[model samples]
Target: MELLFLGTGAGMPTKERNVTSIALTMYEERGSFWMFDCGEGTQHQVLKSPLRLSKLEKLFVTHLHGDHIFGLPGLLSSRSNQGGTASLTLYGPPGIKEYIRTSMQLSQSRMNYELNIIEIQEGIVFEDEQVSVSARMLDHRIDSYGYRIEEKPKLGTLLTEKLNGLGIRPGPLFGMLKRGMDVTLEDGTRIIAADVVGPPVPGRTIVILGDTRPSEGSAALAKRADVLVHEATFAQELSDLAKEYYHSTTKEAAQTAVEAEVKALILTHISGRYAQDGAQLLEEEARSLFPNAYVAHDFWSYEIPVKSREEI
Candidate 1:
């Protein structure tokens, strides 16, 4: 799985960056993409990337701020025109469903595919055999939420040498063995998959948050995350301004990562006030404390390494 930033600017759009939107490329895992906060021009942002519009199956909106949701109507309209045939599911805090429905109705926007909207309260928002997502309210101006996504451990890999040594002769049995099934040899011998299979591969977790100040829930939601995408709307030098606006500073963003014990931290929702020339300073301030911290930009992508069961 991979993360692709569609827009990373905070507050408003600028010539250099658009508003807040992120796409989790999960086609390899589930044959679709999951979007986070469809900001203005998000569909336009997707057009600039290699993403297939038809593969957008899920959306998680953090809050109902204009910068976070202005693109929903346009994106829905475009999906209809672009022939999106798959049903879509959306999850967010309360009011998201009504907001989308009202926006589409007033704008006369039409959708060709089925849309499933979910207003999350707390606890597990989504769960399947392979993955589960939890939501918790964060300290934002509105009823905002942060999502913690955990991918379940994968089954053990098939040990070819063990199977070959037992003369198990691979065929459709390999599939069964990979699924942790036992097989019986033709010579009246029995081989169990657990006895020969490797260990379970550990899962990966990721946390993404919307606009908020430095809060304990933010750190809790991102605990031990492989990647934490957070908002750093201002430099550390502007801590006062950040607090005034109820946004985080570079130091606060990195500190959140450190406190959460995240493997990597990506700072996004940047304020356009920092000109292009000031980009390095913005990144340096965060990396100074958290060496693994990365400054996010529009279209930036990252792949979280997944180890085989044997390696894990």
Candidate 2:
């Protein structure tokens, strides 16, 4: 999975950054993309990336702020215009449905595909064979939420040598065995999948938070995360201002990551006042607390590296 930052600036668009939108592309895993937030001009930003609106399957909005969701209507309308017919589901806090519905109605926008809007609560919101998503309320100006996306543990790799030793050549039976199914051979010998298979491969966890102050819920949601995407809207010196605005500072975000024991921390939703140099300073400040902390810029993409069993 890869994270594509379409817009990373906080509150408003700047020359260096747009707003807050991120695309979690899972083309290899699911052949689809999931978007988080859709700030203004997000469609224009997508045009500059390799992501396709047609391949977008899910959207998770953090809050109803203008900078976080103003581009929903335009992006939805453009998706239909571009002949996107796949079903899309949106998950967000309460009032998200009303906002999307009202915007589409006011603009006379008609979607060609099914659009599902879910008003989420603080718990598990979505689960499938591959992934499970949970939401937790965050300390923001509004009812913002942080999302914990946990990939399901994958089946252990097939022990080809073990199977070969048992006179079972590669075939459809091997596929079933890899899925943890027992098989009976022609010689009347029963093969137990668990006995031959390796340990289950641990899944990766990612926590993406909305605009918020550092809170216990944030750390809980980010516990053992492979990547913790937190908002850092202010530097260390302006931490008081950050708390006053219900946003996090670089130090606060780093501390959250450290407390959560996340492997990496990516700071987004940067304030527009921070230019390239200022953004670098924010990264440096965060790195002082957490060595793996980074400040994300618009259009920057990050690949979450998988961990081996030993590392986990």
| Number of clashes found in candidate 2 | 0
lDDT of each: 0.89, 0.93
What would the TM-score be for candidate 1 when compared with the true structure? 0.97
Could you give candidate 1's per-residue lDDT for residues 126-240 as a string of tens digits?
A: 9999899998888878988889989999877788998888776678888888888887877868878898788889888989998899997798899889899999999998999
- List TM-scores for all candidates, in order: 0.97, 0.98
Residue-wise C-alpha lDDT for candidate 2, range 113-183, written one tens digit per residue:
99999999999999999999999999998999999999988788888898888888988998888888998
Give every collision pair in model 2: none
Candidate 1 colliding pairs: none
In angstroms, the error of model 1 at 156 is 1.5
Which candidate tops lDDT?
2
RMSD of 2: 0.9
